[model samples]
Target: MSATVSPIREPLIEGGKSYHDITVDLVRSTEKAPTRLWWIAFLISVHVLLFGVFCILWTIWHGIGTWDLNRTIGWGWDITNFVWWIGIGHAGTLISAILLLFRQKWRTGVNRAAEAMTIFAVMCAGLFPVIHMGRVWMAFFIFPYPNTRGSLWPNFNSPLLWDVFAISTYLTVSLLFWYSGLVPDFATIRDRATGLRKRIYNFLSFGWTGSAKHWQRFEALSLVLAGLATPLVLSVHTIVSFDFATSVIPGWHTTIFPPYFVAGAVFSGFAMVLTLMLITRKVLKLEQYITIGHIESMNKIILVTGTIVGVAYLTELFISWYSGYIYEQFAFFNRALGPYYWSYFGMMFCNVVSPQLFWSRKIRRSLWWTFLMSIFINIGMWFERFVIIATTLARDYLPSSWSYYVPTWVEIGIFIGTLGLFFTLYLLFTRVAPVVAVAEVKAILKSAGDQYLAPNTEHHEEIMKQYKDAEDKGKVYGSDHAHSESH
Candidate 1:
């Protein structure tokens, strides 16, 4: 194609050519075959899932009695699992909604997988409360709906009831937020699909045509949802913390629980994001899309949140001592040097001290180190919950009632099973859902400009042409030395 050599209105490149004459090819390239590693991950996750089923069957036959639950410590691994999974869901909204509001470009790389993590984590979380209910069928009694035989109503003031509301709201809103972004990408698949795939994509696309008007409305709706979700994410965890803080137990009754829990939620959530992104970027061959910048940004958040959580831990101990409450003081002492002291220290070392290493750029950028760190962070976060719930409840008021709680085989089974369930769903989502937001990526690649665009790039030439014409007219006719400034 013929090209202009000079235009006073456009900024000149090193060669003194105006507008840089950038060109971009719009046609996307696809991989020839699914990566071998993805198949390996899928198979491994399935094997773990089968082990989970065996555990569930054993639990069903053995009954709740198989798990240790004394009067003083009614909640144990089940509650910890619930909180851990819910906390894991937190980062998805933060990455998607909070970062989106800030217009952070790096989010495009991680948001899809993070949102998928939120949905799967929530699914894993929902199981604990249901399975813990024993009958499981009567789990709906937590709902506020009226019963025919009795004038029964769930206590709105209770945090558990609030959980029903908060969890439901978070899951509903996150699903909508995720699907809203997926629509245009789904349309891309719809256009590319054949046979039965076409019908499935067609229904999911909702007649999307990728018109500018559709994008305009879609962007507006996304922003609105993000606004709604930002507070919703914070509130969900705050309410969850209240489930502990509102209690009369000495360790659980602290005022700092809300913010502490929020920090931990975000900390664990970001860890989960890191875990998934590290694997996905390689599995999907998306290293160019999900650059090192994105991982570093996530690591920074993890580091900050880790420090906050560490501070919360120290502050709680300080307040417990300063308050001069014997029970509160004992709770802190027990957590640090009690029977489960190893667990407490493990949580501290993993959640608090370890993330400090992420401050080093080399640690953040190293794939093997990042992967190990993410796993440690998750383990640390899980132990944080376990220590909080188990340690606190295991040694409450009245020495007569104080008894150490232990998780039986069934309890262990269910806990392990949840991990299986989480990865199983995540593995399936990788295959079925768009692993990355293709449409959003295209928009980003377009805006980021010629740095990523390559030769035979005909589609963007029209854009360059219009841009040049607009720039040319805006300049005043002048000598070769003349330059036009952008308003």
Candidate 2:
């Protein structure tokens, strides 16, 4: 009888890619010189970064007056962008830590790039609060660290200080976890390179020897880091929500903010991951590794989180009305029907209505449609933060004191500058390393690869070469360890 195949199951790695094929294909982009397309993208990003730097310097020279902050609406695009960036960073840790714990094989395809996105996005997020302080030089006043100016201490009670602690800790853990995974992969590149390149990669890989002992330590360390990072995925965003939830402002002081913010973060995080990967898969000829199956898995998450965010929106409205507090009711009412009604509606359409389209399998799996939807979701998430900040502050208690918050060209440029900085960092990351996790991807190849799952005549012959001796002698092939040897 012939071996039967399960129709319900699909290959995680497509194109019947082999173990050898994985190394050559994944490492090819990094080995080759930067393409003309990469150059074009890099140049555009650098130009944007330069313009943003000029704007930041202009703000510093001109003072906070260069921004559009006023008596009524003191917060503007700065804080909005800060929260937005932090939300974008959440998916990296979640995918790397939570999925690892649960043993989800699909996460292997995208986790490396997602982790890098987290670091870059957090770096972008950190830039805003420092600049928002106006007296950028005295930003140290917000920190609890002792300085030459005596034992000056920041208020322990301040939610903003809590933000400084939570975010910094989150970044530290994420960096360590990300780099640990890169070590083995770096050794792979080191083995393949010559002269200066080999030396550099050797240093980066920390002299990895592919020994059983080395693999054991790597696996143990990954488990420990995964355990540490799992809590951070929940804690970081929950702490961020505290920035608004702890506030006295009508729209800001709600119990739902914690869960609401967390869900919205995951929602936006997956969308961003999708956005970057869609472009990357096409650009680097990685459609086989980052396949349609991977896209569908992530899209399913976007759908779930998007629905949670929509419910949170409704809950906010219902609570404001149910509380029978006029100011509270008006706070949300103004968001829906007041001066910033456009953003409120746009947020709803993008975060709620757009994601509903993914209920259909074909639509969620369509790369072009998914790309377009991911962009829309990111924009909507940005609008959600804007609504929470600008709309709530713009139409506060006294009608006469109410003023509109507008971002000056300086503020706008700095925001764009952060975007440029984020992309610039990511592009450099793609150039230097395998954006996909080569080691982890190879680990799952036999279990999840299409050719391995259902071997044809060609696959059967290759399998015989790889396993004939082991099968006869009942011996293992190198202790179930990945054969990391270079041909």
Candidate 3:
């Protein structure tokens, strides 16, 4: 069969064949070590997950009184964790939904895992609010359904209600968005399956045939979903901030909370992305696919968002002082110098000062340094939430109401248990799903960059010389041309 050349430039393999035409057996090709690493992760996460289950059961059997919450120090690790996990969720949506709208190609390497991270982190976050209600079973009271006992509705005016709406919306939208991206990938696996796996993959694939027509619609739908998710991302964090903004509490009530919280969320989210991508890129041996350039791009975002967060901190302090509200002033002061001052200082050092190092190319490119920075950013973000919730609640308006809150064993166990939940979901996702988008990879592999195509230049030069010799022999045409010119 004669080869038909494509009008568009096609990616050439070492032998000048199209890379897109090469079929990969992912099961055979994927590294054994990565699989082993995932198995180890699975085993560890399961143990921790079981431990979390025990903590939940113990908390349920005992009661809310088993924990350290009081009237004064009502919110503690629960709220802190909720905010932290939710913030982690933001990075995925930002990378996939927001960056996609901007047509950023580098996002392809990170978006899949980030989206998975978003879903899992949100799951971890949703657990806190439910469990923190003391009577875990009675947590449904936050719902807006009509009650038989009285005509009571959840307070629409409350930030807690806003959080309920925001988080539920965010989770629902994120799941849909993530699932939509998975459909084509699931089809790829389905085609490679057999027996029981075939049936399961068929169910998941929903009859995807990789038709060009279907792909066109799929692309359009993905764009629409990305657009929807982008706003939802911003709104979710803004509403989370409103949980603090609407409160009459001094440090918590600030106009700057929305942008500040969003910035902080993106900052923490990118850090988590870096943490996961660094490991995955190395473990999966996807160096050519992910590339150092992708890591550098994320590092730039981390630096930008981290600086924005830093500015927000300074702004919060400035506003707190400028408002002439003594309570606000005191709240800011207490954050820096109060009993929990060390946590606040830790937050500043980790979030504000630590990420500045990423501004340098050397630090951003080093995997070890990026890993350390990611961990530091996570710790700092958690501390930030703690400072916001714990410090604010610890010292309210009245001295009589002032009290210290310490996490009981149950509280700490539940907190540690949720980490298990996050990891469990993440590990499973990496194993079962295409951790990277197969179609997008195929598409990237199809695009030939701006390099001139060269094929056997030595042979071509010889052919050109032969053509020149043949042309020189056509001097009869030159003689005819001279005769016509003389006439």
Candidate 4:
């Protein structure tokens, strides 16, 4: 007797949907009126957003003194939040651009929402530096435009200046990439719609037709943008890291900052993506399109990036000890055993220990555990930022200037407000746009379609013969006709 082997199964999509079915299922979300849950979520987000706006206005009127910053701790919650949000935006590019270039079919399900999240998160991140300037009206001084200040220009060598160029370019390229992907789907909506929707979608579709030539162009354009965005994503966080690494501060001055920050960014970004997608999948009834397999794949990425970030943390400690620099060693020591030791430990637990749960296949596949882990990762990443910014600044070499920094209600409100802003935009996006890429989902349907399992070669041949006889007998097959006829 010969041993039998079962074929490995992999489904990037579920429900055995056709291309037309995918278009209808995804586009219906945009066409339908807001559900009760959507309304409730939107209203709550709006209220929170309004509160954030009020806080911003109040801060503007009260000036920078409303927050808890002193001479010792010049940077606090504002910069921390800025870096945190920016880091969260990295997963979008990684999923859409990097994964696309690498030919990862799994990206088709989640890339649309991930890219949108990137835009919203970056917008939220951009607010902090502007608001932290105190005189928000004079924020244009960061630009290099000629002014009446007699050839005085923004410092060309500053990483802060580099951030302006980097973020703007990133946002622009991401927007174009996202919108370009949406064009064909928008045309699909326009064709299926009537009256007011027809007119609106027509405009949004930018006169796209399903011509072969057009698709060829679209594919080329997408590939080019993905190529451009790959480096931009790496550079953006690298420059952000420069904001710290280039500094004279002991904790901030390390050559490892670039790669460390990039890994942390991807780690945090994936966490946020999972957090939102899990909620969206449940509420929007999109489990078939964004299946359990998709969740598992994303969890694997979180585990990998989380491990990388953990390694970076240990490397930082090792380097601090090996450098033979007193300030650097003390900075690392203080982070682990200082007034903010709780936060440092929190970072270690959330970022390093919690993700280790995913090593088990059962835990990786469990929705609840995955969601909880994602939230924990975000919490750990936030504390990591706080530990870096506060612990180092609070305990400088000069004891006379040493003071613990704490965020005031104003700073707290601003951070919460940014959350409100991000959610508001995301919720609105869910309503107005197809949360998943309809076209890409349709393309992958063949791979994820129903499969027949046979225990052995004989069984598989027997099953195929039966199907062949049925086809020869003029039985109508519902699957791809060419495939059935060929057999």
Candidate 5:
């Protein structure tokens, strides 16, 4: 006797959508005129971004002295916001490149938006270091080039300079990977377009004809880029951590900073992704494409990364105590019990304690709760940066030199401006580009759609045997009727 096997479970794409339906749904947002809601959000983002630009201009005109930087705290909100934006960018690469390499198909629903977020977040991150240079005009000095001013070159030993190379390389590679994925989708749009739109998409598509060779190259390139990006995602943050770890500062210098920073980055990055995707799904009506399953999967990641970050926090405290170093121990204690202790506790609550709610299946599946938690995670991560940078610097080794650092209005404006800039770009991207990867989503149609079937060999054989037995019974009945009629 044979037991029956169950078929594969639920579909990734719900509502029984076809390949054409997927294309239509994704491209519809791009083709339609901007909604009132879109315009409202865009204007708000622009307003904030412009304000940030004004603040940046003010800083450049008056010099870096316009802000709160002083002898005791050379890096304050500028570096804090820089690290925050950089960490937020990491989730995009992790979702798009790392998950792709791991063969995680669920990534297809979120990768396009996540990749865009990464690019925009990096753009925001790059601005801080550049503007932090008082003479923004002389920012090119950070790059190594033969110049008339002797043989002056950027110091290769400095992790700051390493950031120059690492960030630039990461940005370039990420752009290529993102655009490569877009080409096929661009071609889809091009084929459906006419006149000027047609011409624009045609150029964007690079004459893609959907040929077997084009797809072959596309897949090969995606795999290659994914491989390159997997190590890159790790290396970029690791190098960023190096900027602090290599320093002589007590709290900053630690062997655990690399993994600690990487985990924190992933945590913050996923939070931002959830925040954006939740809104996108609701506004753009993409529930069928980005289902509850996708949201739940991301929540699990947030839970994992958040826990890892919480452990790192505890470990740092433990290591400081165990080392019995005066400065190190004082720094950790200062972070918790000092003047900025509120920020530390806030970070702990948001990053460490909040994500634990995901352990409940109900909360993970609830849209509103997920969104609220994502916001909390973002806040916690920001406070984490504040605790790391400001608190550590506010109380230095010497009591005489210790001073509190507060962000001036200029610094505040610029940080707020970067937020505006990020949203502005993202809002525009949603309007013009496919928020969902059309081709990638299409590729998964067979496995994710309603028409999917189980290919269990045992079940197939059992069904075949039942059909043969029925046929034999019918033949026997027919033979009996013929004999009875003849008699």
Candidate 6:
């Protein structure tokens, strides 16, 4: 396709980075010593992770009795954190798979980090269900593998059991999708690296060469994995919603949970992506690649999904009242006016009220504002889960069993620990791989890059087009330029 005139678009890539400069700029952080800021962030995250690990061990030794899970509230912080992390992880595959399939060039700026976030977030999320099991060692029972005792089989009918398959499959496919995109980038580092680092990256990259055949297979495999991952994005969260929606509890059993949860997942997921991205772009000196345009684009998603979530929230309430189900009515009423009213309001303010700021383009484009709001949205998402679980579970069918639920210090620690663990992994990831997709940024640089950086001259555009044309024909371009550049 040829570039045509349009209303002038902001350059997705700033600073006129050539294909070579993209490699250098993206890989520079990995090759150098950790900055003071990097160490400070890493250490803080590590300490938080350690605190979380201690809490996990304490929970394991003492059992969930350490948690404040009462008779009425069997699922509290653990389940809430589980859902929150899972929702947070959704942006990765959404960026990598869904955006890739749609051919959105903007995804190049953030998809690599988002995909990594999905993997790490899922790791943090998977912890909750296992630990919440009370007996941590028997966590494997959720797996559908054949048991030694023939009669004692995993419950196929259980939604919790469905989570095992759905999440595992999602993780596996996401891992593949994430790693596949990293191969050429890894190879880039390998070529640029020294003895030991070169050897390591060479192994990681599986000896990738800038051959026509290699790029051909890489693109093909990416599509296949994206095709596999796209459905998992929708299905994994829908199955997660079943954990609540399939329940008999008044507010819990509803047809709305599937779409509600999916929208909420994408909402929170995009918010999280923005939060991490804002920080990442700053710390890594990647402003040229992860530009303000990327920020505005993602915020648009947050606006759309946040609006969907707001409607879902209203729908849940309307359905309860309009259905004339006394139990459902009381469930939502308790959430608003009952003991947990504080959390309910927080949820509404953060998820619904706050994201509405993005209706103003200036607000969406502002870094400080977007970062601040991202934090707000995530906190609100946690509140939303809490309201859903606590309000519904705390007051049940039997009045005598009704009680207020509060998380123990242990629950809060584990949740914070997961936060720490997530950041710790992400901080470490910056050292090991290019946070931005190096190959992909190059792929779209001509078309989507800044106005000045675009091939305004015939010579430059032709140089860029040779690579694009070969890529389209599934053959590598010539060695007239750098091998990695053409690759």
> What C-alpha lDDT do the candidate models reach, one value each?
0.80, 0.91, 0.81, 0.89, 0.91, 0.91
Clashing residue pairs for model 2: none
Candidate 1 segments whose C-alpha is farther than 4 A from its true place = 1-36, 449-487
TM-score of each: 0.85, 0.91, 0.86, 0.91, 0.92, 0.92
lDDT of 1 by residue, 408-448 (tens): 87778777777878888887777666676776665555333
lDDT of 5 by residue, 1-487 (tens): 1123234444567777877899999999989999999999999999999999999999999999988788988888998899999999999999999999888878999999999999999999999989997888999999899998897998999999999999999889989999999998889989999999999999999999999988998899999999999899899889999989999999999999999999999999999999999999999999988989899999999999999999999999999999999899999999999999999999999999999999998999999999999999999999999899889998998899989877889999999999999999999999878999999998877766644533443456788778678767775566567678998
lDDT of 6 by residue, 221-249 (tens): 99888888888899999999999899899
What tens-digit string does per-residue lDDT give for candidate 2 at 158-236?
8889899889998899999999999989999999999999999999999988899889998999988999988887888
TM-score of 6: 0.92
Q: How many residue pairs clash in each candidate?
A: 0, 0, 0, 0, 0, 1
Candidate 3 least-lDDT 10 residues: 446-455
Q: Mark the 10 consecutive residues where model 1 has the least summed lDDT.
A: 18-27
Backbone clashes (count) for model 4 = 0
Residue range with the least summed lDDT across 10 consecutive positions in model 2: 1-10
The alpha-carbon lDDT assigned to residue 450 of candidate 6 equals: 68
What TM-score quantifies how close candidate 3 is to the native fold? 0.86
Off by over 4 Å in 5: 1-9, 453-487
Q: Give the C-alpha miss distance for residue 417 in model 6, angstroms.
A: 0.9
- Model 6 is weakest, by summed lDDT over 10 consecutive residues, at 1-10
lDDT of 3 by residue, 1-487 (tens): 2232332332222222233432242222322235666788888998988888898888888877777788998889888999999999999999899988997766776788899999999999999888877788888889988789586898898878888999999999899888888888788777777888778878988888989999899899989999998888999999999988987888887888999999999999988988888887677656555667677788889899889999999998998888898998999998899989999999999999999998789988888888999999999999999999998889999999898888888888888888899889887777677677666655544342112223334445677777667667874566568668999
